[model samples]
Target chain A: MTKPASSHQTLNDAGEFAESIPHEKLVRSRTAQAMLWVLLIAAVLFAPALLYPVFVMQLLCFALFACAFNLLIGFTGLLSFGHAAFFGGAAYICGHAVKVWGLPPLLGILLGGVFAAALGYVVGSLAIRRQGIYFAMITLALAQIVYFLALQLPFTGGENGLQGIPRGTLFGLDLNNPLPMYYFVAAIFLAGFLIIYRTIHSPFGQVLQAIRENEPRARSLGYNVDRFKLIAFVLSASLAGVAGSTKAIVFQFASLTDAHWQMSGEVILMTLIGGMGTIFGPVVGSVVIITLQHYLADIGSWVQVVIGAIFIVSVLLFRRGVVGELARMLKISSV
Target chain B: MLKLLLAQGMLGLNNGVFYAMMSLGLAVIFGLLNVVNFAHGALYMLGAFVALILYSYVGLWFGMSGFHIGFWPALILTPIIVGGFGILIERFLLRWLYKFDPIYSLLLTFGVTLVLQGLFVNIFSASGTPYPGMPDALKGVVNLGFMMFPKFRLFAIVFSLIVCLIVWYVIERTKVGALLRAGTENPELVKAFGVNVPLMVTLTFGFGTGLAGLAGVLAAPIYSVSPLMGADLIIIIFAVVVIGGMGSIMGAVVSGIALGLIEGVTKVFYAPAANTVIFFLMVVVLLVRPSGLFGREG
Candidate 1:
């Protein structure tokens, strides 16, 4: 069980195998990265012309939310079923600050993120006490508490929700305009994506992966496992908050739906469908799901049935997810 | 006020019966499958819907005037039907998920839940449907001097208690119960003793989900049989499971009733807080004893 040398050797072997693939062949190869950048730039430039800005903005928000969720589940091996607490909780806070307190959009969003981080600290402290399945249930139960609080709180507007929030100016630019708001959301998403990328490649991320792979071994190696998990939890929650805040501004409203358990389940679906533990998986997953929802809106509740079927199929047969499968087929390992 | 309290306590105990039944299923399923059965709520809803269909449609098909199968038959039949469904789910869907991380099973069950709920919502609109109350024999309230208790509710409470006790007895005292305990502790060892562990696992899941179905049938008359009924009650039951500690049969039973009573009392004193009191208790429990009231520390 304490075969540290063999485990380390296996890790090195996998690393070598990854490295053996030529740079151009790798999924995140320089040319591939350049192509992705070009595609992203093109999408940002052309998507608004083809799609509604609000729709695009919503997709981006969910994409970022899924990515933040992936940070914990994929990298740190913590499957939280209560992420809507951060996502929806932040949305409410940001909406309240912007609409009532007259804060600028950026400040409001930041305030929401900060609040989510604090919430993460408190929730993570307690939840991290349990491992695996219990952890998921604990987060879920706590998130339900948050949901109830949202329903009861006057500021949340109860069932009606916090509606008609003004999309305040960002850096003196009126974000009420679609193009500016779209670009603003796009920029925030890019920054978030990059930050997640950086974090996963960082030393802290290395420790997290180690813990995910073997918690007991990681602990035996003298790492503070709980602290690492808590930090990852906070980071994931804060990023999720950022996505939620941006969503509140883009929509100019925050509703109880944002903080719902179903929303948490939706994020999980997005991540799982895209690729768990892969950098681009959640983005791809969110895009596919949001796009499906956009087109299938006419079907009403049938969409849920389809989504459920997808979840079952994905878990049973396509566990690697779309991007994860793509990476495997391409013979490239992606973080 | 005292009478009101007594009435609320009875209501609470009634709700507790459902909670105990649901959580018992959850604990049993979790103990063997190691999956949280996120679809437990949906299964509960399915149970009620099954009863409703059996009452309405089965009678209609049989061409009998008002031959709706009432509470008594539903109590027996709903569990069998739902438990059979559970067996199918375990055999086909959940079986494949065992090798993967427990989260995948959760996700799979969640997907199943969504599908179940969606189908029910599509069939019978989201609004609550009324199931007829107890038959003529069980109609009327009992005057207990302190307060009046509905005969149907009293029957439900007593029936659920007996069911809970029988499950406890079977799982704790009987020979099969010993095998189940052994299987839960070490399936491999149990298998070495020639016990068909996998079959036990499937049956355990069926039994657990059967309990959920029974609760649904029992709850149909008391609460409006809505598509969202199980979804609504499930989160609270999850809290109960957490408070009692998952996989603890006795813990689920005791805490389910205890929490229900607590919630009932809270409803009388402060109506607003009633919905959230159990969650608050859960948080406090976590802070004080992370493993829960009856759970052994890992």
Candidate 2:
């Protein structure tokens, strides 16, 4: 086994080379992400019969969740183990709004996103006080508290869960059918994905990336490191909430499983398996894992074992994941 | 009120034993290897299940079985077996990730947990297996006039204390202990001393994992051997580790018992919401002291 080298060696020594690159040129170069999103839209619009809308919807939600997760881990150099609080917490609120408050699906989704953002602000504010492993543990502890709250909350229906939620009208358009619902989910997912893409390409994204590469130097450069870290954390969590709320609408249910720590782990797995820091890797990962789940459902409990084995193999052999390594092989920097 | 407090304290002591064993292992692993060992819970679950299997299939008596092996043997054997598995893990999967991102270790161990839990579900099928306590030696209820408590509960408390002292003596007093401490600070210097740092890391992981296994063995009779028995418990122990400060063994032990009793008292007074009070305390503690109650400031 080779000795562990300092992280300084792996980073490019020639710094700020990409700092002056134009935004338009950067956007122009993302042909891969643009093409993938266009293809996804087309698939949603025309390929109704070829895919199970529910399955596709699930993939989109998880993909978005994974991407949101990557925002912290890949860009900010923070690994949060408590993302379930934002994701699942938002789902519960959205589900409750739609089912009980009788709100429109769009408004419900926004409400869910807002709730998660609020939670994200609180958790991120405190968690950012620590670095590395402590941050992960703090997030985890907070998420566990959310899980307990979900269990006891009357609106959550406890272990039985809040089920049979109506898809309701999407701004007066019925979304009860699978096709319309698929379109709605696809549109939301694409919008969220593009927002992430734009954020990653913008000046803010570069600063965050620099922080991930080296915090002390960024601090020396007069950056407000704490504020930047908190912003990244809250943004990642809010996006995860959007994904979770969308999932609740598609599945028409929200349960205790959403808040469980395992769900948080699953999101991380999706991100890692896809490619960290890559634009569309999480989407691909969600597709692969969701597809695997569909086919492997018959195996029941063994699925956990198989996923576990994949995780070990991925960390041991394919550390960069499918898209991260593939992007490198093709010399594509971002996507 | 005094009697209620005493009862809560006793229950807290019982719960503290579990916290000490599990969190002690986690601290050791984190200090030496800087890995959280997410699979610690799985290994603990495995120990309980192993004891259950031994009792059922091997006719190894512990509680209900005609032949009584008692808790002592189970404790020793469980850790030994669990520690052996931990050694294998350190040698194979965990060894490779020492140079990589710490998150990789977390992911790998999380996967290992899934596999272990899945395997148990496949074999045991969700329905819990029985785990009767030791022989009639400690079966009866002990009346303290104030509140009647089970003799087994008292035994569990005492046994864990004894184990904690022994482990503390070995880790805090021995010459090997000094070397282990030094290894945590600077493995390169320790390696120069010809102590074989890699071997020390492996042994530390094994020893830590073994503590978790021992906790499982003790817990078997207290709680049924189920697939999910250790999953939630480990999360609470993480809270304990965070509260105790991850670097100090003594802190882990003291905080574990203290928190457990605090939880127990919460159960007695605010029974409706006792389940989450420990977590609430953790959040408050984080706000007040992010490094934990016992952790040294950076």
Candidate 3:
């Protein structure tokens, strides 16, 4: 009984090492949890109509993108400046696969993830040699090379990009329809989000958090820091690819814009604005940013100006972000 | 063969001018503030626009009074104006974020880039704005027996080299340089010595930003002043900084010129793919020396 109690305590200590959030504060009542799910279901069922499906689809993609980004930043404490390479590269690959090879959408998306994962493994190895800002610059330089390659590569279709990608049928059900596609996107987003959540809560996740807090300590504890970081990078890039692939289907277009440096910056902005380490920050941030873009698309490049202002203000005044600050105030961790 | 070599050398020299000034600014800012300053390019773009506006409207009004203020005035004035603006930005935006991670400053500057770029595009309407030349003082070609070079471009090369030398001297040789270096390496100790570190940081930012503006003004006469000109050059300047390794001022100045020449030669040999060669070189540099060619391994 003492051994079991010791193990339980160790587990608790491992999970909440930094914050020491109380279990009571974390554990939601069954009724309250049920109420949350019901409200979410109602909102989905009633889904807003002015391009609601499109909006949700966009949010799903970018939320997954931010979550993927967070996998490196929050868990591994490595900030990648070239995440657009993974995201946009996968979009091109997935779009090219489905349209040119006539592969199923699921397989195509998986292939995209695989391509991005391979790239992550290679770039992550080189990037891990440096820490902090150097890592960021190295990643950015590598991503720029990828962007150049994408421009020259024939499969990417250069400047015009691979356009009119067929969404195809999902297990023989047409997802071309707006509402059905919305559900499909939501399911995928939820699945990706859950996978990330599960990863963060796993034994490996504990090791990663240890690494993030103090890598030397984790290394001393017999954890292979570099190996862990590489694997995390792969997983994050693969998930980003999943988002990019889904986005390719939703938009039926893959352009240089996807692979551009600015796209990378935009994804970073989304994650930072929403909250870096928090679970639901990406979702909220994606929703807010996407909606801003949607309504303000007519404002032209001022959108970038506005987003930049938000970035400065957010970093300077409100680094905790919307959901992050809320969770801090409530004294709970979402994931 | 000698003539062709000389021709290529001159072309490289012309490019060297742009790269030296741009990366010098980057090095200055990175050394003092530890910010990558993505807005450096945007500031350069604004400098060109300032010159254009001065040439178009200010020239017309001032010309009526027979004071022909040309590129000479812009070469001095635009930088002061833009540097003044940079001082404001440093005080208001960048100064507070100094205690935080350097990455936040990078993000803040990137935001500034977006705002500045947006304003430029809004005003300039996305097309190229051409600036007229000097009053026959330095135009046409100069023949140095082996090759003929554009006089304006040659002047630009000589002018930027002088500017780079002066900047290098200030950073490397002066007492102010010692204070700034001490502040950068360890601000707490520097502040304990009773120096106003915040003001130093702000002034350093202004100097770096003014360098960017100076490059813009010089480039306006040589190249078309377009909204996108800065974006096109910024990436190259970044490569130069990475290669130069931000630690040594001399390294920054030397590598900036070297990289510009390398890029120039690449354009001659492989014209179609010249734009991407610098980035590939960066990868190679990283693989070879991760701390960069001139950066110390810490």
- Candidate 3 lDDT tens digits, B186-261: 8899999999988898899899999999988888887788887887577678777777787888888888888777
Expressed as tens digits, the lDDT of each residue in A1-335 for candidate 3 is 01111122133535655555566875753344455557655555566464567877887899899989988887777878889999999999999999999988888888998999998988888888776666777788778878887898878889998998998888668979887778887888778888998898799988887777666667899999889988998899889989999899899888788887788888888888888877667777887888899999999977877887888788788877887787667666645
True-contact fraction per candidate equals 0.67, 0.66, 0.45
Worst 10 residues of 1 chain B by lDDT: B130-139
TM-score of chain A of 2: 0.91
Provide a comma-separated list of chain B TM-scores, one per candidate. Answer: 0.97, 0.93, 0.94
DockQ of each: 0.53, 0.52, 0.33
- lDDT of candidate model 1 versus the reference: 0.88
Single out the weakest 10-residue window by summed lDDT for candidate 2 chain B.
B56-65
Sorted by TM-score, highest first, which candidate order results? 1, 2, 3
* CAPRI docking class of candidate 2: medium
DockQ of predicted model 2 = 0.52
Candidate 2 accuracy as lDDT? 0.83
- lDDT by residue (B1-298, candidate 2, tens digit) is 8899889878877988888888989998988898988899999999898777655655544345476445667767888989999999999999998877677797788888988998999988877877864657878789978899988888888888888878888788999888988998888999998999999999999999998888888888877899988888878888887777887779988998888888888877878567777777877888888788888642
CA RMSD of all predictions? 2.9, 3.3, 5.4
Give the range where candidate 1 chain A is weakest over 10 consecutive residues by summed lDDT: A1-10
Candidate 2 clash pair list = none
Better model by DockQ, 1 or 2?
1
**Which residue segments of model 2 deviate by more than 4 Å?**
A1-34, B59-70
